[model samples]
Target: MTKVVFITGASSGIGKAIAEYLVEKKYKVYGTSRNPDKVKDISFPLLALDVLNTESIKIAISTLIDREGRIDVLINNAGKGITGPIEDTPTEEMKSNFDTNFFGPIEVIKAVLPYMRKQKSGKIINVTSIAGYMGLPYRGIYSASKGALELITEAISMEVKSFGVDVVSVAPGDFSTNIAAGRYHTPVYENSAYKDSYAENLALMDEHVDHGEDPMVMAKAIHHIITSKKTKIHYKVGGFMEKFSVVLKRILPDRVYEKLLMNHYKL
Candidate 1:
């Protein structure tokens, strides 16, 4: 039987790339866009789903299950980017980011687990970030949200293992995506304590995204994970240094690792 794969946030970026790739590989692919009606020129089904809404998540999953009868794999790719100093960024904005990146994925996972458990097999891939492994300056909230999801992936995997529903996370480094455009950025205040550094880092972050690796790299990595017989708890796809930074964090002392990040950001 052909595998049925569902992806969230599939209107563009990594989600769209994975959906398109899987479609070419002969999988039944259903992807979600917040405004599916507005998205044109698509080859696969793009359903309307807003990650922040639980009802929307339930509807989208049920809709896919209705058509396919089974959802073999789910790519939890829906997320929001938040950037700014931790102090300056509104608490509401931080909460909103967590809603999309952390809580939202959890809800989606919750909806899928029962079906997957009944089927006795499933794969889940949560799209995380390299920055999530370490708190980056200016990108702290974004890092924290994704980082929380990354850890959650591990715990969920263990719980779902006996049921045959495998869960994992893909932490991509700097992928060239429209994320920067959509990012919620706290204003650079004229008299804020971290004004100059925050402003400079904001520009640098955008530049990194612009020069980041292609999203197709992530697409291919995910495809491999889906086809594999056994899955790991976490898989990271990005440039060497980006992946290495995670290792550095593990080996380096706290202050040393902090210094490295500060130096890189020129803080």
Candidate 2:
């Protein structure tokens, strides 16, 4: 029997790449997009899903289960980036960021856990970011959201171990994707005291993301995680420096690591 795979944010970028690759690998793939009509060009089934909407998630998952009978893999890849200084970004904006980036994935995971638990086998992969490990200057909210997801992934991995369910967080460093186009630029930045640095750093960050590695790199890492018999709780994928930075955070002193990030961002 073909293994059933479901992925979120499959309309474009990393999610799209992963869904496409898995289809090529001959896995029964079902992907989600908020606007299914918009993603009609994709090869696989693009179910309408707004991760922030509880009903939307439940319906999408139910639809998939009705067709496939079981979901072997669940990829929580739906996310959006929100950029601005911590002080300048509005509270509501931060909530929106967490709604999609953090709470969204949690809901999907909750919906799939029961199915996986009963089957005694499943793989859950959450796509996080390198910023989750360290609080970036202007992208604080985005980092916090990813950081929150990272911890959830870790905690759930332990909780679900007995059920034979594997939960992993895949932190991708700057990947060239359409994330910037969808990024929420808090208007508060225009009137804040940190406006200058915010603009400079935001622009620099966008440049780096635009020049980042191909989304296929991320897709490959996820494929490995799905197929491997024993996978780590966290996997970092990107350029060497990006992966090394995570290691530095673990071994370096707070001040030293802080200085390094500050210098790297030219802050």
Candidate 3:
């Protein structure tokens, strides 16, 4: 039997790459995005969906189920990054980040659980980030959202282990995508209270993103994880530096890790 996979945020970036890869591998794929029209002409089924809206999520899931008897994989990859100093970040923006990144995936999982549970086999892959493991300047809000996802994946993995459903998280480091182009940049004022502290670091971080890893690297990783006979709960994919960073975080103390990150970015 051919397996089916549903992916969110399939309009572009990692989601699009994964969808294309899966389709090439001969898996039936249903991808969702807010602007379905943008991807409707693609080779696969593109459904209109907004993870932040429960009704939209329900409708999209139903549409997929009506067409395909079962979904073998659900990729929760719809999310965005909101960067700025914590204090300067707008309260509404932070809430939006959580809505899309954290709750969005949860809602999708809830909607799909009954079907997956009945089947006794399914994989849930949540696209988190390296930020989930370590905090970085100007990324507090984004990190918070990804961190929540990590915990959710951990808890759900244990809860559904007996049912044969697997929950895993993919934490990729900075990948070359429109993420930086689409990033929500909160204005930083030189004369503001945080100016002296955040000004230089913010510029340095922005520069780093200007030259990040290629998005195809992350796409390949996603493909490997989903198609694997046995999948782990968490997979860290990136260049050598990203893998090294994860190792450093695990081995170093809190203060030591902080110093390393600061020095790496020349902050």
Candidate 4:
């Protein structure tokens, strides 16, 4: 039987690349986004989904199950980036980021678990980020969101292991996607407290994202992890620099790691 995959955030970037790649590999793919109209012309079936809304997630999954009988894979690739100092980031924006990046995947997984449990086999691939492992200077909100996702992936992997379902988290370093251009920047302190510090950190983060790796590298990694017979809890995709950075993070003391990051950002 041809495997069926459901991917969110499929209108563009890594999600779009994954949909195209899987379709070519003969998998029946259903791609979802908040704006179905933007993806209507795409070759595969496109559905309307907003991860923050539980009802929308339930409706999407129900529709797919009614038509396809089983969902073989779920790729929680929908997310957004929020950049600014923690003190200068608005509370609502931070909450929104978590809703989209952390709770959103949890909601989708909950919705699909019943179908996958009955089928007795399925894979869930969550698109986390290197920020999940190590916090960055300006991406306080985004990093916290991804870190929560990483913890959830770990707990869910153990919970679903005996049920013959697998959950894997893919943590890619900065990638060349419109995410940088599209990142949400909330200046909570226009002329008030923490303005200077927030501006400096935001500028540093923007510089780093502008020179990130290609998104296709991450897409290929996702494909490999999904098709592998055994699931790994975590996978990282990036250039040598990213690998080296992770290595330093592992070996150095917390203070040392902080200093290195500060130096890299010229803070």
TM-score of each: 0.99, 0.97, 0.94, 0.94
Could you tell me how far off, in angstroms, the CA of residue 141 lies in candidate 4 after the best superposition? Answer: 1.3
TM-score, structure 2 vs. true: 0.97
Residues 131-229 of candidate 4: C-alpha lDDT, one tens digit per residue: 877888778778889989999999999999888899999888877677877688976477757677667777766666678887777777877887799
Q: After best superposition, candidate 2 residue 98: deviation in angstroms?
A: 0.9
- Where in model 3 is the C-alpha error above 4 Å? 196-203
Residue runs of model 2 more than 4 Å from their true location after superposition: 188-191
**Candidate 1 error regions (>4 Å):** none
Clashing pairs in 4: none
Q: Which candidate number has the best lDDT?
A: 1
Better of 2 and 4 by lDDT: 2
The number of clashing residue pairs in each candidate reads 0, 0, 0, 0
The lDDT values for all models are 0.93, 0.92, 0.86, 0.86
lDDT of candidate 1 over 172-224, digit per residue (tens): 99999998988998999998999999999988999999999999999999999
- Tens-digit per-residue lDDT, 166-256, candidate 3: 8999998877677776778788786678675576766766666667777777778888887788888888887788778888888889898
As for candidate 3, its clashing pairs are none
